[model samples]
Target chain A: MSAVEEMIKERLKNDIDPREFDKPEFQRDPFPLYKRLRDHHPVYHDRFHNRWVITRYWDVDAVFQNSEAYTRGIYEEEGPYKFGSRHVFGPNILEYGRGDRHRWLRNVIAGQFVGQKLNDFLPVIDMIARELIDKFRKDGEVELVTQFSHQFPIRVISNMLGLPREDENMFVGWYQALIAGLGFGGVHLARGIAARNEMWEYLEPLINQRSKNPGEDLLSRIIAAELDGVKMDMDEIKGFVALLLAAGGDTTDKAIANMMYHMMYTRPDQFDRVKATPDLWENVFTEMMRYDPVVHTQGRRTVNEMALYDEVIPKGALVLIYLGAGNRDERVFKDPDTFDAFRDDLHMGRENRSGRYKDGKPGHLGFGMGQHFCMGYAMARQEAVLACAYFANSLKNIRPKFKEHAGIFSPNIDSGGFRSPAELWLEFDPE
Target chain B: MKLRVDYKKCEKAGECYYNHTVLFERTDNGFPKILVEDLTTDALRHEAREAIEVCPTGAISIEE
Candidate 1:
């Protein structure tokens, strides 16, 4: 056997604990551990963390599909706000709500993101991408993540929500603090709470103004949106806006960074193909998401005792559907480890939302499925595709900037749960 | 076989088009359009059933 194949076999044979994911080495490269988990324990429980880590495609997809059996309300019980405050995410946040309330909130916001509404935002997204790229075009080398990827989505989201463009930095800081606070034992919980308060304080007067004098923006639309004559209150609107900032900003930023990382470092050939054919950006983004998604896992609580993969999970148990692992499942994708943009076996468009794989091909679970599928998916896609197309068209001789001696893809760290390089430094010739 | 879609209930999640493209196509605005309103083949029936089951909004149904 080849050296790489032998190394993989040896690593899979090692008895690695699921909790090893907390360790830096495993965090940097978890696919070896994921292989072991998928091969040995598809539904392994991490006793230390007190949660079930599901690794296989079918099991993860099943959890996403059966929302009734496994609800996102788990976030309420074990989330960072469990002990601190009830209003952290607000009562009407789409992620926590279930049944009719969830549907109403999703549909209301969904209208703002679909059809011509989304088309209108494409120019805004393209402009944001060009402006962000312009800032670093002169510099021979740039830290793409912090300088470009991180700021682009937040800017677009700020425009979409009718927020001031100058305050993008503050919003980015708030999102970072809030996401960090969501970590174990509320590491930065106080910071998160303070940020939320600050955001609400800033938004209250603006919301009131919009209510009195509505405009052609998302905030105004929310102020006007009603389901069966039930309008969202200030707190509900605040909650929804907070969720939008956190979800829309963090997820899309990481997605763009992850896609770029994969393109330049992991699969340069695919990157070249995309640069050659601009239309392939959609396929490249879809395949990149399947290969290395930004959001690695989502936590759900079991509503009742359930049996999966010959393992019985008790009621009220915390189950994490590992999207990264499912995306690379051997049973689902041929040579799952390799990143191939033209792979015919995987469903490309809105896979996670539908979970309806064409010809039984099985789609990636980057976005969750069923009732709680990501409401901002279309918006996210538009931003990523536009940004990617811009980069592919504008940059020449794009390549990763390796460290002086380490000879690696420039050392970078992963955030909690989400898998993305903290900083992706790349050298490119401005076209 | 008749394929029915509840337009009011349809969120345009796009399951039908992605799963069974031949049977359903999306409009310019992204809503699903049933191409073969009357699916007569057994193969089409199986595909339609899968689409119905996968629809997050439960907007699609098959009737004999």
Candidate 2:
């Protein structure tokens, strides 16, 4: 057997059960199973997780759009409603809140991220990407994920929140711990609780200082922001900051790495095309997101018993909206498996077509749709596109180093929900 | 083609203004402002259509 095949087989040995979606093998390549679910059981009830997994594009989009029928249920006392540890208090984080509260928080937060505010962050993103690339430009070979991709977003977010640059390593550690806590089982959950407490302790004082001596950063802006003349309290401010750090840092980090991985390994021809046509970087990033989004699934709850795809999902049942599956659904995408940057059938960015037509294509549900659509969609896009453009413009002969060692394109693992290369080693000539 | 924005439905995603900067500009409050109410040139109309297609909330519309 080939060395890479043997390694993969050894990894898959522990994940023998095909139905276990959380298994490492399933996480590595869930598309085959996703195709099965979509074809045979569109509304399959996962008995293990006790949730209905929606795989079809239309059904997933419907669930996202119909917020009233399927609420986030973020405030519910028990189950998966509580996003973070119970220790954190004040108003629920924007994602967890429902109804008017969600709208109010969303508006307040969304206001800080549009147009000029976003444009202002472009230079900051560009500078960071350049600096990170410069650090390893002469190294000849670099682990892109750990050394660059994972750290860039955290630094940018830290700067935005007015956090000290020297303390970025601390924030990264806290983020890792907190995420570990959010993962499956008790040990990770305990770690998550500890991380939350540590984060709260660290942030409370900073939030207090911002409340009194507010600066020109996002933390200060959020502190001073008001919805209908009611300002957010200290705890709410902390919540927002935590959410920003977590979402902005982790997701953007993974996204940039994923895009690069796709370019270097999965779609080198497209990468060459992008290099030939520099302007296509934007389209490349858009298509990269549509083809293989970082966020694989989002959790929601049915507000009431609703009939969908011939299955009557019960009230208060947890629903896993399989965005990765939806992105590749054949009914929605032509040649869904193929990665096409110039696919005319797909809307590029934060777009949502009213209806699907032969000439008209709806945006992928990567950042989601409707009221709960990702507030950071534009910011993420800008960061990714800029970082990618810089790499494409600056780096020469960039290619995956794993191919020589193991005949594998990428060493990255999907890990079920989020898709990022665990460690992306690439060799590039300095420009 | 006449362009209009449904301000109430607009979440200020900013796709329209960025995609068609010549035809739309952002107000002080960050919402979109139609730079030219009636776009006569085909290029302007094309840009406007692209902007409309990318609006997440479907806030922008072109009237023919």
Candidate 3:
């Protein structure tokens, strides 16, 4: 009924599918679109997008926490797009049912993420980060995302899962295809189908092998753990494994890329601080997760008709949680846009504030929250700290020399997340 | 009462249905479904609670 809603409807009608707009080109800079939706078409339904996108943070968070009212059905189920088939990822949304079954899966994964499982991965993360930094120190110029950001997390996750080194590249390739498909357009539908098939096929043998001889990987451990003497089947195991890959790989990879881009562009001084104190490297990691989260948006569906900020979201209508906007909300944070590394107030306690929250207040939606917080979050934080420490300790003299590129989205504005830097060039005194 | 489930919250680990096939089973889409038409008995209630606790999405609640 509103002009903006009418306009968005018209655009959706013309666009064929809202997801097609999520191409690498558009994803490179989605803020303009977000702004438009936020200002004018805030609650407009994109039937083509197959969901209503709520850009404001409060609305998103409300839907996030109110799981009972907003069913998480769409994301968990395999509709037109799923990462793998029954043959591969097993049952599509096994961990996503209603009733007691749903809680069981959450508890298992949550147990892995909540406390000690995270601490166990710390040393492994440190080793991997050092190895990467040790390798790249000689090369002054590096694409942070591809060279470092992307590589670190996957390796750590793969190692944690006890996946064969040989299969790492294969899984990474599938993950890219799968994430790229989230935009839900013509390009992605085809890519999604193909990637899904490939992933299932690839997992067939792996799943079979793991079933016969369970290994030391998290996947194997999960399979080995039985509920009252009943073991998880082959299909369920494959799905959980693939889901783990998705959770562990893409978001953290992008987070690293975003963090580096911000340091290079907005606050070279922060990099300088980390370079100077070394310990400050942890603050930079915390700030990065708080600053420009890679997982920019999340979605949920209202199960009961609800009024959000007075706007009625009908039961079953999709709602989005905008982490990107929330982190920068002027209302919640002081100088929301400014990147301050040495702010003691934000980093209240703990030994230098590396991973987990310094204040313990949900430090932005970097890893999300509530019933479905990221399971591999601790590993993600460890990888970030490891990468930063490696860069600071090893590439001591190196400084950023990123190209000047127009921002695709908001303040962060880069490919990895915010400052969509075409390339990051670093210069260091030759060793 | 056939075993009722909320698909959004179910992670499809199938632990509930594993113990009682008469009530719970895996669906075609890879999640689990409750087939029996009754929610009676302390055992059923206990298993249901376990399922709720394990659900990743918090998408389930027992309806007695």
Candidate 4:
């Protein structure tokens, strides 16, 4: 190649160093790199990472929706290995892929989180928001993560589970440790298991109590939940509850914190619109999910050799569907990188697992569509929106505590892209 | 083959209608509406099976 040809070739190169994913700059702002992936290498085979990356919106959706080609279950069912033996949260519904048990568990457990059943739990959400806000309202300024966002969701969950109000702090501690313990092996895993065991022991009596005399709480519902004469046993019940505390608690808390971080920093002008109209908090949540969601990537493995854009991916290949990248695909979304809540292209309404919306607009893949879609989709959205609106309405003139912020980050490359600001400090007068 | 959508278990994910529009279409609401309940051809049966398999909720099934 000539000199001019070489320079042009350099510009045309779509190569993405796997190390870039680990760099601090990528975590701080990955959209530029995401755009590069979308524009050039739609299906990137990262040899270093031992995974295939799909960045386009529709491709991610296709993988998520197609159980015929891909599976969320990483472990082989027929293997000598026990399922969920090494899972951070233990044996739970998530480890299963397209099976009768998964369907059964999803059927019974999912209902409690949606429709009128979910509506019944609304009061607990509002009550917790009020309680948390009340504590920091006097301080005039509070760290959203520590003071409000972190505490609110877990407390709501604990309250919904009918756990003792006084033990809410313990629940919070265990969840934090549980989340911190995951994706990093050794000491983190050890601490996580310790926390899980401690919480499991604490839940033993509660599960027994609920089973004997069921109440309106979530724990009771799980214990009493049955379909086709099948019910979750002791380990399953406790495991699900613990998973909820970590998975549900982890996502919802980070969501609230992310929204606040964006509103107070990324889009203060747009934040004004939401403040004026509390209902706009829904839009903020939706946009935030697309813009910089709590969960950025979901892991799925290909079950068969499949033809992607140009290359054939072999069966049993690890595919990392980068929802964050797909959310910013210029093809599916207009002005993809810029966060615009009122943008007319997005669904901006209640999302479904199929990734298809009635509005003819595509939905964000943050929750990961299809069978294994975020089971807590409605609950997470409800909790995050209510808490945000609660914060917006509860705190008058709430603004960032400091003019300079470190912005949102994943803390570690292998953290699996659970992005949230380390600390979100906001100051506002008591409502 | 006759198709049945167990509405009780259905989350209205649109997998059936969205994926196979001829066999199933959207109702007045977002839930899937089976256009042709009876399938005789192998192609049609294959499509129905695909819908059943893709459904996040095990709502779709063959009647017999």
Candidate 5:
């Protein structure tokens, strides 16, 4: 074996079970394994999947922040969701590009999801949140994930994209199928493909309509958006719209659900604290993200052979940066495991000291760093903050009936993805 | 430690002041007009950074 591969094998022996890749249980509780990997092989390799796993806070953060060493193309591979010729756009348009192209593409979409744009949509999102709560208020129990969590983001995104409510059900199915690929393999893979096709079928006509007669929706805006006087064509527009629905819906849905789960699970006292200080919704959301980042690991392929973690990583090697593990690194966080909702620390950005610090490094790896950091991060944070704040202000007797363990269906650290209590089981007193 | 915002870059998303009213405040113009600054306090710095992340234009930053 090559020297690098040999070192990887040795590291794998110390951490990670061989069955973790395919085992449902491992997917559910991969954190223990992730913790071990961080402890043993901070820069370990997995021969089984041929991926290098970076687990230390500094190492993972470096991978996330360094666009040169760790690139985003490796992570945006065409998965089972790739539809045949039925799709108008090629695979992985926005999520897989490099440098300037990526930045430009991000800007076009960011125009809709970030900054004041989010504020513009707050009223709509609030309406959706209230409508969902109203439906479940009288019921002593509500399955949060299926009934509310899943429903809210779908409607909000669909409306944002100007997709009619008639298409909302189909859109939800597509999102669920695409997101399922992160967890279940076979059937879900097929479902994701079918959903992709269905999405193209649904979006093609919509794209054509927007092309002929544009409106105020995000779809119309992107259709009219320009880059250096070069307008995005129908195929490019479809690709972005599809991507928005998939990436935006899944991440935000899971994040909002995860925030609620963490609030009720780890810090019940904090839940009460939220009620006392509804104004702290923003802080609560930040703490929730810091405590349990939904997108656990982001992958990057090495652009060239380079020295990493006191070892050499060959070019084209897929690198897995363990984001969740980084958030809990004792070297950065004071008490990495404890969830302090009111942690008076700023947990975002490079120079900030919000993470759990052991030695000195910052502990937050919630959003990947650098250029490829989550483009929709601002919007996602807004949705979570508003949603959580609304819940605190309006709902009553909100608590989990049965304990929820880490969900194995979605990717690492997305515990609420699989089946977030079908209902939040709140008696929504609407105070 | 006081939080400083680059009003030029701030789109006034209100994420900073919404979450950290203790250390930061937003002006009517939607920019995070930092209420206070403490360069040494890690707590204040952390909250300031969170505000910075919420800024869509990427305008907010903490200065020691």
Candidate 6:
């Protein structure tokens, strides 16, 4: 925009109130305010929240790419930190910043989630997905959130761990409470910590058994995955399993719901095409990752002074990267608000850590980019795709119960802006 | 062409060595030690690229 045009736009636009973030309407839908922030205050320093908000596409990518300027993960760099001792997850990978410790943790665990190793777990994913769908298939109408969406991934995780099939409900309960405490404080945090401690104690014997006699299960694989004979210690192993259950399970749980919400409600026409071809389910997954990702805000702290939009963010400032805003960024996407599953502009394949694609298209910022990109990217995408395809295929003529939903929102303030339909009711025929 | 390990970029996120042991091996500290740097055939180059693509940090690349 020209200087005169920019001035006019600025004059017409009203300043944003930081309190707007706390409102229910913003919770239900954040894109409007996100647009305003992107256009006017691309690098907004919200005084009320005492944090810098990054909303644009390139800006969010820049923060993810530049490790020199920002630091992610749960622990701080300044103090002497005991790995995962303090957090509810107990010394998982999330606690480490960018360093040798973080790299070592990531290297050992990441291989299990990608390539043939990830594919090895496919039968379990399919079986669990089928089992969950079987529960409500005979009913012809199902409350998807509790009945299918919530139960599916947690069961898959448990089964992968070689847990007894009967103990899944216990894992589910722990997962729910643990997720509640993830970023939320007060009562939720207390419950979450209690669940974690219980889970840790429960895993002690299991870890011991695995050490003595390893098996073909994921838990055994995790125990045995080594680098130059160095391996994850007991605490690290248990912490990772805890992290995986919540981080991998809960986020994927939300992701599956989001895909259904968009397909059944937002774009019923596209749903018709997908139902007709069925292969387009992958496109639906890709579009949902861009259109409205489950993970909206990714936090980073400025480790060095940085310049953005004529303003300098000093070191130690908290930066909230709004990926929800970035996906809808007009500068990067054409017809940014509309959810088009088959759009050519967006990279519609599996995501990679380096956001740059061989096709030269910008992928969704949902999984994030660069160094700290989601480790479970491949597994999450595959699991969601599998679950969605199975749902649409197995349940004959599956569709939303009603045209309207309560809309996606963070259920609680401490939910860390994770948004999805609280309840998804769907009507389908038994196959 | 030879495989180059960008030490600065590689964070030892074991996507390469663990999955593709044919092209790389793990160091004691978990960094990927290149086992086959020399690529003389299209198949070898293909194998090298596959390794490069999976690195979480984009630390590995082919050097001509």
Query: Largest DockQ belongs to which candidate?
Result: 4
Give residue A78's error in model 1 in angstroms. 18
Range of the 10 consecutive residues with the lowest summed lDDT in candidate 2 chain A: A407-416
Task: Using TM-score, rank the candidates from best to worst.
Answer: 4, 6, 1, 2, 5, 3
TM-score of chain A by itself in each prediction: 0.88, 0.87, 0.77, 0.95, 0.84, 0.94
Candidate 3 regions with alpha-carbon error over 4 angstroms:
A1-56, A75-98, A182-202, A343-362, A406-422, B1-64
Worst 10 residues of 3 chain B by lDDT: B11-20
TM-score of each: 0.80, 0.79, 0.70, 0.87, 0.76, 0.86
Candidate 4, DockQ score (0 to 1): 0.21
Local distance difference test, candidate 1: 0.75
Tens-digit lDDT track of model 4 for A1-431? 89999998897676778888788898788888888888888898888888888989988888887865898877766777676578777778878866657766765566667767779989889988988888878778888888888888888878777899999999989988788777677887888889989998998988887799998778888888876677877888888888888888888988999988888898898988898898888888999999989888888888899899898889999998889999998888898878888999998977897676556688888888866878789899999999998889877888988999988887543332489988888888754
Model 2 TM-score on a 0 to 1 scale = 0.79
Which model scores highest in lDDT?
A: 6
DockQ of each: 0.11, 0.05, 0.04, 0.21, 0.06, 0.09
For every candidate, C-alpha RMSD to the true structure in Å: 8.2, 9.9, 9.7, 5.4, 9.7, 6.4
Tens-place lDDT per residue, model 5, A1-431, is 99999999986577665458567664555567767877877877788888888877777766654566667764433454432233322343435536555655665666577657778999999998898877767776666777777777778888998988876888887777666654555666566666777777778888889878999888888888776689876666767776777777777777777777767766777778777776666666666556666667777889899786677889998888877777777776777677787664444322221222223324356766555656677677777677767765666777676766443234432222432322344334433
lDDT order, best first, reads 6, 4, 1, 2, 5, 3
Worst-scoring 10-residue span by lDDT in model 1 chain B: B11-20
Candidate 4 chain A lDDT trough over 10 residues, lowest sum: A409-418
How many collisions per candidate?
Answer: 0, 1, 42, 0, 29, 2
A338 in model 5: Cα distance from truth in Å? 1.1
Question: Which CAPRI category fits model 3?
Answer: incorrect
Write candidate 3's Cα lDDT for A149-267 as tens digits: 66777787778777778777777677666555544446665675577678767777866777689876676676676756776676666667666766567666666665666667778
Residue A410 in candidate 4, Cα distance off native in Å: 1.2
Tell me how far the alpha carbon of residue A82 in candidate 6 is from the true structure, in angstroms, after superposition.
2.8
Model 6 chain A lowest lDDT segment of ten: A408-417
B1-64: candidate 6 lDDT, tens digit per residue: 9989998787555567645667887554546788887998887897788677667667888888
lDDT per residue (tens digit) for residues A1-431 in model 2 = 99999999986553324355866557677788788788877888777778888988988888876667888755654455444445322234544636555655665556455557778888888888888889888887888778887788888888888898888889887766555544344666566567767887888888888889999988888888876678986667767777777777778888888787777777787888888776677777777777778777888888889887678999989999988898899998899988888888887644421222223456777888655777787778777778878876787788887774221111132222367767778888864
DockQ of 2: 0.05
Candidate 1 segments whose C-alpha is farther than 4 A from its true place: A1-18, A75-89, A92-97, A184-187, A357-360, A403-416, B1-3, B6-64
TM-score attained by model 1: 0.80
